[model samples]
Target: MDKIKGIAHKYGNNINTDIITPGKYMELSIEEMAKHAMEGVDPEFYSKVKEGDILVAENNFGSGSSRETAPQALKQAGIAIIIAKSYARIFYRNAINIGLAALELKEAEEILDRDELEVDMQAGTIFNLTQGKTYRFTPLPDRLLTMLEAGGLVAQLEQS
Candidate 1:
């Protein structure tokens, strides 16, 4: 898990939680809701996405309610990581708590859809294989990295 390699699914700004998971589907199980993830913005999203794909986007990538399920849906839908210019504090925390790798790359808009990317979390770098370029992101804190490695906060607590 040192590096994450995947095809990118790029998005635009203001990608809210409601747009990501749709509030109506909130009562459903995480798995069931996952099948409808991002449906509000892209009706074919669930079908279009493949396991281990990376989600890239511009500013404010997770902006609505503090629903942890929003991030859970994406994770369940097989999004391996998220690269965005910025993120809502709540959504970012939720992603980390659930062991979903959500990184911030100021140059996220430079990445294209379906671009093959290799990410080094510890090194804070993204290599865009398709575009033949590299981007750097802010490194994660040591404690947060530890939580992610143990599979989110709950799992980390269990291990402790």
Candidate 2:
């Protein structure tokens, strides 16, 4: 796939799943749930987000419940990718399973809100267009990359 370019929406550390998508909205469908994504942290989040936007956050992102709704909410809201210092194991897996690219990078905190980023998933490099700098992170494994490229696990399975 081609490189991903989008505006960044930065968040602080320990941003859990509950903040990503509150439990009250758990019963909602993916499209409905998206309207509530990040509502706990930013009441205007959904309104401000554009398709192909990127989310950048500090460590321990997605630390709460393992509900897949968090990632699904983000994907449905048109989040192209998420970059964090670290992600809760289940959240990381869920993101990829649902075709929302998530990356871990020590320099995640360096990214600022509204900064334009160009991410090369294959090279695992993030170029900050606003700051004229670049950061690197480990690329996803082949299997996960394949799944993400195919638009998540279900789509990948159907292809095979």
Candidate 3:
């Protein structure tokens, strides 16, 4: 499993698809779309995030729409992972399908903003060493883990 390290952007519940990757910028190119990713919620998002950074949000993430572009935009923007309290079913599936690591944690709100996190996908653990904390999550199934490790469904299929 890949190890993800980054500063967190913590937000509360109901962070929907539109806030993640807005519809108005969907028609743009990957580089262009990345510039607008998360612009709805955080205007400085694109400028603030570095490659391999992670986004941490509360429950109902990726709600409001089933658009695949939501995850695509984040991936393009160089987000390595997203750990949330809960995710919309379609968005969760889409995120996994596209190689973006996402985990559901029960105590998501407990994590502070800008808290540096180290996520171990294989171990199903998030190490918040900044504050001497560790959060555990339900591990993804072996098959799903395989897909995520191989860079999502299409890459997994291609490998087969």
Candidate 4:
């Protein structure tokens, strides 16, 4: 039941895992892989992003390979959360496993780039501060929420 407020960066549909981290950078560490995040689609993404920023996408995000590095790159790049119209199943699971907050909101397309957003996971609401609108999304399941709160699967397992 935590809240995240940040500026949203919008992306289009079908943004796959290869575009997220790129295959070439797969061998690099998380910190290094982060530098190449979204380089395939948005070459300036790394340069423009800052800690606590939110990524908003249209649909089928993380559509390609099931590589976990994609989510890891985003996490390391300081993406606090990702809001999308839809997410690939594997990517969704990988994101939660790594403690990266992701929400599926059909209205996500309405959010514009650089729009300030407030996401309340507890209430399953996304408030667009810039647009003065509120969007409701299905809340993550309790178990998934717990995993994210504990800092992903590994951390949750360690705690038990």
Best by lDDT: 4
| Model 4 residue pairs with clashes | none
Compared with the true structure, what per-residue lDDT tens digits does model 4 show for residues 1-160? 6689999999999999999988998999999999999998898888888898999999899998999999999988889999999999999999999999999999988999999999999889999999999999999989999999999999999999
In model 3, the clashing pairs are: none
Score each candidate by Cα lDDT.
0.92, 0.92, 0.87, 0.93
Candidate 1, residues 1-160: lDDT per residue as tens digits?
4898989998999999999988899899999999999998788878888888999999998998999998899989889899999999999999999999899998898998899999999999999999999998888988998999898999999999
- Candidate 2's clash total is 0
Clash number for model 4? 0
Writing each residue's lDDT as its tens digit, candidate 2 over 1-160 gives 6799999999999999999899999998889999999987898888888999999999899998999999999888889999999999999999999898999999988899999999999998999999999999999888888899999999999999
Specify the poorest-scoring 10-residue window by lDDT in model 4. Answer: 40-49
Residue-wise C-alpha lDDT for candidate 3, range 38-135, written one tens digit per residue = 88778898888878878888889999889888888888877888889999999999999998888999988888988899988888889996788999
* Local distance difference test, candidate 2: 0.92
Q: Which stretches of candidate 1 lie over 4 Å from their true place?
A: none
- Taking all chains together, each candidate's TM-score versus the true structure is 0.97, 0.97, 0.95, 0.98
List candidate 3 stretches off by more than 4 Å: none
